[model samples]
Target: QPFTYTTAPVPALTSLTPTSGPTTGGTTVTLTGTGLATVGAVRFGATPAASFTVVSDTHITAVAPAGTGTVQVTVTTPGGTSNGISYTYSAAPTLSGVTPNQGPTSGGNTVTLTGTNLTGTTAVTFGATPATSFTVLSPTQITAVVPAGSAGPVTITVTAPGGTSALPSAYFYVSPPVLTGVAPPSGPLSGGNTVTLTGVHLIEATAVRFGTTAASGFTVVSDTQITAVVPVGAAGLADVTVNTAGGTSNPVSYTYLPAPVVTTLIPSQGPVSGGITFTLTGTNLAQTTTVLVGGTPAGFTVVSDSHIVVDALPGAPGTVNVTVTTPGGTSAPKTYTRVGSPGI
Candidate 1:
């Protein structure tokens, strides 16, 4: 005669992936151990998990159910309930706000965050990019230095032992204004020339400047374009700049030309009948568009930047005022003597 002995067939649970989750549940945890092929039920403390699937003799995937605080996770088979493993459930964190939410794409800007359940935060991010640095100030506050981020609106979030905060589109990244060039860069010292400025991120322009002086007027044509009126400035190079929401742009050089000058008039004396050719000496005369004798139009030709030949118009026997008009401006008047006939 022979004697036989009975053995136990209980399931053994060694561990669970993601040992913790939010109390609201819905976290899928993997159970690993021996003798789990025919698991009948998986439980978080006294409550049973929502759903579970057996992969083999040693693996099972289960979705957690609603519960609070720490709980013992266990599995049961036809033999009996298995030994329990520990798991924790915590509340989801809430984010009320983030300070200084807007920053340059170049990053390295410090930002302050305000919210609840922020203590023991493991990470902070703008979009998917992690912060350059961060410090948890308290359960409801955190400070983080943003990493380089792409220009545009983005969501900022904080992760702690509880979970990642579901913050909405809570931050913005702005690209600084950059100026490539300004057309018709040079104008007369008197101002009033329309200039076109081309660049990047030029929308919502608040101001345009010539050197230190603000432009008389401006219009934002696009994110990369702006039209401005040149303002009155001294004769010299003026730095042109555009200011937008982003910031001031790089400078483009503009030159202002002084008013035309008339130093001397050749053959200062002329016949009362006029029609006499006169060679005028002056500075900045190349752009001369008009010549006048006693307020009357006189034909003129710009021989060079410094010289102009003009035909004197009819005037009275006495002296009359002679002026030259150029792109820069009209020159001061000079005396032109008109002689009467000796017979008269």
Candidate 2:
């Protein structure tokens, strides 16, 4: 009787562990399925892998070979070539930094990544969120626009032909700062006044401004404290804002006071002897009105919401209006002429 030899059928590879790795080699790949016992060679696409060992009838361990793009692994045996297997060859690109780590929730902001193996990048993502736009500027650089997202921090990932690199250490955070109040609500038009800002999420304040004018100087003390110099501005109320790495704060009003203006002097004629009833009319009068005679404040009485009566001292007979001063500025003098007799 003649001895008979039995041949096992080649197995079909269902999948490959870490189906992808660098073209530089040193990656172990496990091929699985029913007929791996007779695998003559493990080929990554048309190129043969570095080495391969048959572990069992259903498993084979193989070292990845250098290549780019997708490749199929096939096993050859006495029965002929088995079904084709597929794997991707990629270069793991690292991300050193992400410029402008923060962006608007609406996304669409361009960001630059710096590191090696960045060429042939296939995809860019912010955590699980995919970027809206991306471009491979060079082997060591990438430019991608952020997609809209919620207010929070997210890890960025870059994928290339070698494989996805480690998740970037830098993160992207999206949130706008909030402003509540401004100290010393009023300031002179000359600027240079220090004002305190109170708000939330002010940790990375970059710029401060009164209206359209940027603050002369600014310091971020904490997430809720900011001191800034008021810029020269027109007389009136304008919004104040602080910009930070997170975002811009809500605007708060900063009042700018202009020099007061005087219109007329009631009882323009007064007794030279002093102690006469008179009224001064002017805009922007101070809350506490003062009667000034020759630049000297004399005794005065506030008679109404917009009126004041003064008892002048025995000074040289002359005409001068009572001037008022306030945070808004000094008011023009109201002219009062001296009369022959004292009148109420």
Candidate 3:
């Protein structure tokens, strides 16, 4: 009697592991059904798969071929070809740019990412760390909160079911600015004085503030220096700070002195010969730069914020005005009399 031969059962595809993938297609898909061990080939629509491997009688792992739009996936075996299943090819997500591409190393700031095919984003990353949070606003844009990172540049990547893409350029991480000192730390309450700020990581400063008031203007001179014009502020100490892309700097002290006001002259009258020393009393006189007696410039010493000593200069024998000047500005004038010589 001749041995009887049994034929293999026809292959049947019940489902596809992943129903969609990138159009550039390299997606590994699992086809599950019966009689898969004898499967000889797999295809996406009319195009054959990049590769395929028979895992068992119930599973076949296949690499989908590069294609576009929706396509039917099928398996072929010695017995017969399986029924087609649906698979979709999508365009990979791309990153064109990121708004405010630089931020503090400590992160937590929101940034906008612009691109194409960004909808359905599964993840966003700065370097290797995932974003603190993110939201898909449209097919071309996404907003994400940055995660903490080391100082310097890092790649920003976006991932979707279709594929992952990185920005063409790098995003930057900046260290927060530091405040060490302020030159000419004291200014008049009326402001307008230019002061130098010294510190580290001070480049790209966007704002300079005294207490709650913003500086009138500022210039970044280097990574460690800046020049800013003080804005009008109340008398006494104000906290000065600098702001950059990295973050706000530590505060430094700034003093605002009220304008000087001359209230008295110890010797109101002096000889026209101009050889008299006199005490001048006033408020905000500590920084007195000059003294004028009878409209003539006179030598002077700042004894304190309320006192200054002056060496009277020769002037016409008559009553004239005496004034003092300081960083707080010229003082109000007081009367000074120069006596004439007495004849015998």
RMSD of each: 6.1, 6.1, 2.9
* Candidates by TM-score, descending order: 3, 2, 1
lDDT by residue for model 3 (1-344), tens: 89988898888999998888899889999999998988888999999999999989998899999999899999898899999999988799989999899999999999999999887788999999999999999999999999999999999999986899998446899999999999887879899999999999998798999998999999999999999999999989999999888999999999988889988898999899888888988788888777887666888887788888888888789998888877777888898888999999
Predicted structure 3: lDDT: 0.90
lDDT of 2 by residue, 73-192 (tens): 887766566787678766678878888777766676788888788877878988788888899989888889888777777888988767677554466565778899998888778887
Per-model TM against the reference:
0.61, 0.65, 0.85
lDDT of 2 at 37: 79
lDDT of 1 by residue, 1-344 (tens): 89987665789999888888887888899999988987899999999999999999899999999899999999998878889999888777788888876767778878889988776688898899999999998888999998887788888888876788967788888787899998876668989988899998988678899989999999999988999989999987888987754557888888888889999999898898887888999899887878998998888888998899989877679999999886577899998999987993
Ten-residue segment with the worst summed lDDT in candidate 2?
282-291
Pairs that clash in candidate 1: none
Q: Is candidate 2 or 3 superior in lDDT?
A: 3
Clash count per candidate: 0, 6, 0
lDDT of each: 0.86, 0.77, 0.90
Positional deviation of 107 in candidate 3, in angstroms? 2.2
Candidate 2 stretches greater than 4 Å from native: 1-20, 23-41, 45-75, 79-89, 102-108, 147-154, 167-169, 172-174, 188-192, 234-236, 267-277, 286-322, 333-344
